[model samples]
Target chain A: MKTSDFRFDPSQVRTGYSHSTIFKEDGFGMNYCSSCGVRVLTQVPEGDHLPRQVCPSCHTIHYSNPKILVGAIPVWERKILLCRRAIAPREGYWTMPSGFMENGETLQMGAARETFEESLARVTIEDLMSVINIAAHNQVHILFRAQMDSPEHGVTLESSEVRFFEEAEIPWADLAFRTVTQALTHFVEDRQRGQRTLHLVDLETTRP
Target chain B: MKTSDFRFDPSQVRTGYSHSTIFKEDGFGMNYCSSCGVRVLTQVPEGDHLPRQVCPSCHTIHYSNPKILVGAIPVWERKILLCRRAIAPREGYWTMPSGFMENGETLQMGAARETFEESLARVTIEDLMSVINIAAHNQVHILFRAQMDSPEHGVTLESSEVRFFEEAEIPWADLAFRTVTQALTHFVEDRQRGQRTLHLVDLETTRP
Candidate 1:
């Protein structure tokens, strides 16, 4: 996979440690202060338990926390929407539409935006389906249960194609992100029981 | 009400806009490169939506997002745990044992740690009770349902007092944060219903 892949196809699912996972492993002790553009000193900030990237020049402490990834598990009747990736890490693989949440947006807003951007689908994003923490990417994946506004929209520029699949039609082995698979599985089981309860799952042990 | 109050009592419930609220209200265009101590220019980085604090000296983009706050509702019998705050915005008011989530920890880990730190109590934190988006504060509050290991512990250094409150005993008017009251109310209602389903609430209406 190359960095260029993410530029054109930024809607791909978050995988292993890129920024968040690495930072969580250690102090995320990255050098160079974005504040003062100087080499930052990594140390336990006074009276704080965790060591942060403290700027000696301006005294601004840099904190690293898990990023939130919001998306929609689009469903029209029994069919669930899927996006085929054109990016690396899982190019040609299928998964739910999701990406790193930007600043200054609610989880729902982010989910709606990502869905529209990835699949060009106008979805009525509904209740929270699952909140899965992907430790590998230092990301919290929050997927919403949604239905098509009218009909499924066109294929977005971010994906190779957009389609829907029922339980038996899902590409389980060819899914892009692990959280997508877990969410889809939950949807299937919950649909079988005729319910949509919120699921909170930790994907720490699900990694290869 | 003083800043020093936060030092020893950092576990107070989130009330009005503090640091995060103000930052979110604006673009948080504060510059001054963390690396070189130079002023960072506000401009759209490559393939980005909103403008970010980009340090020209070090060429680093500073991205900021709303933070997560996690805590647990400590229950013993029918009473829920409450902590007296010594911090500003609602000093001396009662609230749940919650705090700003720290880096390098899972949501559950942060909730457990905050519970232990604020009340010195050992709780078996269980499923997520409520995940609220406090838009005014630009924060997400994730509350869990937990049972006291034995009995409720003593007052923590971060609290003026630690005690339990039944439905009628809850100090509604004296609550430190709006989000706290909502979570506790849910627990009370859910307890009455003989079930505790996960609640995904957006407490935007509760804001001033």
Candidate 2:
């Protein structure tokens, strides 16, 4: 799917469109009122700053905010973990195991869970290495520097393939997201220097 | 107000309540349906794992997630910036100038905005110092280590008082939130050691 397909309404900020990609993929928002069951209206609520889905009858305002994406940069000596997506949107592309954060879980727990679900790897997570802002999607991507607990990890249903790749073996051209690309690039550079610090950057939404 | 009162629902985790304190305070949720103005129910959707506020009439699932709270540990010389509340919830208590992260703004920008709004201080924000999970409140508090661009920032109507305090002068017992207490404590410890690394900590909600 095109990135534009995922972009939300500017006025609404988080879920900008009356109906957006989220509604298509996650079955969340921009439909019958989650409150009163009437179709929700897109309007700026009184005393509010942005355009929100306001229920006309009960005057309830529905809000959506940027979601957190968590992942790990699993490092074992000189290699990094990589997964080939078996899912749509970016099927066949390689990525660091990552997914939407679940409720009640800390970013650390969510990142570790995604690692297990996608690669079946149990990792000892370390410092957060990256905090990438993907404004177009209203999401923040946080990647942690991690180490493997054992010698082996297997691929699950989410990943058609998985392996540890040397810096030279990274599939730069087939990477899944810009945040992923930026993070891997940082890992390579930091490795060469024998040092690393937090890599903070923003991936602006490419709008026409 | 007690921190327990701020904690939202466990099952309804971001609205953070047995019922949302936000709804009670901001009228954000926990109301009759906004669309139909009818009472909403909490139920697990057809394929979802978590319980959501679903409209019985339309079957729309209202989702809520933890909000990002951004602020700064404004350090200058050997002191830090702090604000005394001029408003309720914790009026008269001391805290780092922090607030809910807003839409369309990066975490750094949002934190800076709060600093300016709370203390009238123009600050050059540096590294994110902490990410404390306040699960009970359905919030993740992100505190940054910051510096003042100039010697002074004005106090606004929101702050009954604004000033810098040495580590000794920090009002430990009278502090506003645990996040504030933890951030301040980190600042003091890091200061004494003459070396500071990112202090990644989770201030868990201690429920009775």
In terms of DockQ, the best-performing candidate is 1
| lDDT: worst 10-residue window of model 2 chain A | A1-10
Q: Give candidate 1 regions above 4 Å deviation.
A: A1-38, A205-208, B1-30, B33-38, B57-59, B205-208
Per-prediction CA RMSD (Å): 10.6, 8.0
- Deviation (Å) of A14 in candidate 1: 29
Give the alpha carbon lDDT tens digit for every residue of B156-194 in model 2.
Answer: 778989998988788999898888998887777776888
Give the distance in Å from residue A200's predicted Cα in candidate 2 to where it truly belongs: 1.6
Clashing residue pairs in candidate 2 (N, C-alpha, C atoms within 3 angstroms): A9-A16, A9-A17, A35-B33, A36-B33, A36-B36, B8-B16, B8-B17, B9-B16, B9-B17, B9-B18
Candidate 2, true inter-chain contacts retained? 0.12
C-alpha TM-score for every candidate: 0.82, 0.77
Model 2 residue A77 lDDT score: 74
lDDT agreement with native, every candidate: 0.70, 0.70
Tell me the tens digit of each residue's lDDT in model 1 across A1-208. Answer: 0001001111111222244444445236456665555678767676555557877887878776667788888777768889998778788999898876654456666677777778877676677878886654556788888777655566766789898787899999999877888888888888899977777777765334
Model 1 residue A56 lDDT score: 85
